[model samples]
Target: MAERSIIIIGAGMAGLSAGCYARMNGYKTRIFELHNLPGGLCTSWKRKGYTIDGCIHWLTGSSWGTLYRVYEELGAVQGRQMVDHEVFVRVESDGKTFIVYNDIDRLEQHMKELAPGDAGVIGEFCNALRVLAGREMPSDKPIELMGLVDKLRATKALSVLKAMHKYGRVSIQQFAARFTDPFMREVFPEAMANMPDLSISGLMMALAYGHGRNAGYPVGGSLEFSKAIERRYLGLGGEIRYKARVERVLVENNSAVGVRLADGTEHRADVVVSAADGRTTIFDMLGGRYVDDSIRRYYDKWPVYEGFLQVSLGVAHDFSAEPQSLAFRLDDPVQVGDQSRHWMQMRHFCYDPTMAPEGKSVVIATYAFTNPEYWNKLYADQEKYRAEKQALADAVIDRLDKRFPGFREKVEVVDVATPVTFERYTGNWKGSYMGWMATPATEGTWMKRTLPGLANFYMAGQWVFMGGGVPGAILSGRHAMQVICKKDGKKFRTSTP
Candidate 1:
């Protein structure tokens, strides 16, 4: 093939990573983003002096683990200060509180204390953790003969392969089921319910081992992360075009030729990679000409996860009653059966004082999992949506009042983001925060890839390689680029500056 240019759609984490990888590998790369900025749902927003992080909770490791090595190579961690979370997270239920620590032994002890007579279950769980302790994850490098060989020779590769051989095909539920304690079963379901069965708790267990080594937060927030990746990409001679909405990936016979933007501007390239929505890329943009039955079924059948409602609050004073800090699950479990009221979580933030004015606190109140039908019916009524959002914010404040007692009075600023907000800003279908859920049925499947049958087209981000967090997207971007590099007979590289 002749010297080729690659065009990437969507400037989310995955797209940015793909761009970087492609540039590193000596391919001319350009990215088109519908939004002006990057980072998708993981990006931060500012409203009246409050900086709210929409989705970042706690990343697995800072710069100590295998994955952190990738970040270090991407130039995302050099000179970046991270604040390790002192307390992992707390779960409050039925008027009882369970504090989860970074130490595996301490976590096991807490579990045992919470549910007496469950020592056997705890030990078994620990054994399972040990089994997964040194496991490896599938690399972002393309999955081919050469890639496999390189991976085999890479550091920690044998341990990863061993773990994969041992536990890759099983579901998380199945792994949890190995222990027969009610508490164990309940805990696994609660923790892993949102996670796909195939997420490799073995990989997560290794992360757990590494988390205590160093679990730090970025001082600036997610935007800083996005900017760092973008900076590196630009430094490598890659181009990122904002407000560029790709309408279709132009194809000649069976190979991806180029892409046509929404404004009817066509740019020619040898290969086109879509880090955008699969449905948007294949069916809507490509006019459904290339889709096979398998791809059709994926878009038409698989359920997309629901969106979130986020309320960012800037308070007048610090709510530092709890020294260690923070809870994951809310005090009350969301009432799935009830539709009249919504479930919300209030996160206490004193992590970065810069997030708010001096002596003030920033609290993020978020609640998700609403019915699509209810939201769709109100599209024509803007005032109604605004009212509902206000009401939702009020409910969150009420919940915070229960938890923090005097939280309602100190509210300096309150800004709400709805599903509509996400759809409008990020162009994700149905405002889904994560793409397709990586359940047992769809784990490690192609739903993680770009919409199938679209020529020279691939996708990255939460949509690919089983949706999880920022790390999954970053890794997937590298994978997509690696796959493209293989097609073009190139080598993978990363920019350090």
Candidate 2:
């Protein structure tokens, strides 16, 4: 039999993983990327010797878990050093401070000390973490592929199942309102990195992983991390083409056959897998021919993670002793385009020495905003866009100077990245870094990887899975490969190098 060849679109986390696994399963594969480099949103850039990271605050499964095997198979976790932080985040408002500790016991004590009135709810929260932290990670394989034994393993953890049932539907914002103390009420909503709409169940799982030292930051940044996986794919005899923008999925007889590039070049393959932007793949590339109502509802009604304004600074000052992340409310909100901001979170990459010079560190401030049209319009006017970027950076710098005192003088470089930058570079719709928002209703929801009427085609990445980011991206890729192997009457195979 001639080797079945597969063509993949978008060289992001999901695309790279699919290529690697396809090769492992004895299939020839090639990946086409829109950008000149890999990683897509999972990347970083250098400015004046400082590396400004755009992704990867912490990668879950860096140490060991069910998902760790997936990372190992994709060449993401091996030979990578993981740094576990003691504190998750330091949130401050009006001189009052709240720290979320990785250690659940210590966090419980601190929460009680800070807000004795809310101790009942505090115990409820801490106990959930304690229970989940002691539990083992679930299987990484797709649920449909699991055997009876695997299904039993998944359901045997009654405590974890009960915990999920108890708190699965509660949003962080809703839970924060249940606090009796005024301070707790005000700060709890923003505790999970200012993602108020995120399900509390999501936070519990992450904190649980962190408590076991299973989740941590890589010593290098996001780009280097993505490069590791790329190297793995190349080593597996997979081919990748940079600057190859896939414009359309060539379909014949209602089946995906190959792809046509922007420059009018066509490539034929036996199978096609897209890890590209969800909106473009369904509505544009496929010409809206293979979608049903479910697909339409997802695109129309689902809430995506809004695009944010990022201010990057390389400072001459050392911040080795400072917290990795700090979220504080400002008395006076700084104007950044059409949005007004009250809270700002500054993240300093002091733990990873590769980010900055010997005596300096890289600092990033992100302001979340929802008005995508405002940025889309501003970007059209080059002068207005440039001026807005500078203004946002200046306002962030000024605020930092007040908080840190003498901080402005230590700055050596200033850079800004907007929604326009992301949309232009990665082609993500609305500049959403993560494809979908991790909300109460969306948690654990799985969209069909194969569109209703499409054959020989599969979609992977954050779009297919409700929970976005690295975990969803890699899993979706693996699942696609598994489905393809099953269809070809071959067993799915994976090997760790």
Taking every candidate in turn, the Cα RMSD to the unseen true structure, in Å, is 3.7, 1.3
> Over the stretch 289-371, how does candidate 2's per-residue lDDT look in tens digits?
99998899889988887676689999999988888889899988988787788888899999998999999989999866547
Compared with the true structure, the alpha-carbon lDDT of candidate 1 equals 0.68
Report residue 400 deviation for candidate 2 (angstroms). 0.3
Cα lDDT tens digits, model 1, 1-497, are 45578899888888888888888888888898999897777688777887877765555446566567777766777787777664555555446565656567776787787766667766655555555554444454555424555765565555544544455566667766765555455444334322335444434453354445554667778787778888888888899899989887888887788888889999988778788866677677788887678777767876566666667888887766653333334544433212543234466567776577777878876555556456656656988877777776776777777777888999988888777687778777777777765445564465435445556777777765555577777888888887777766766566456
Residue 468 C-alpha lDDT in model 2: 79
Point to the candidate with the largest lDDT.
2
**Lowest summed-lDDT stretch of 10 residues in model 2?**
134-143
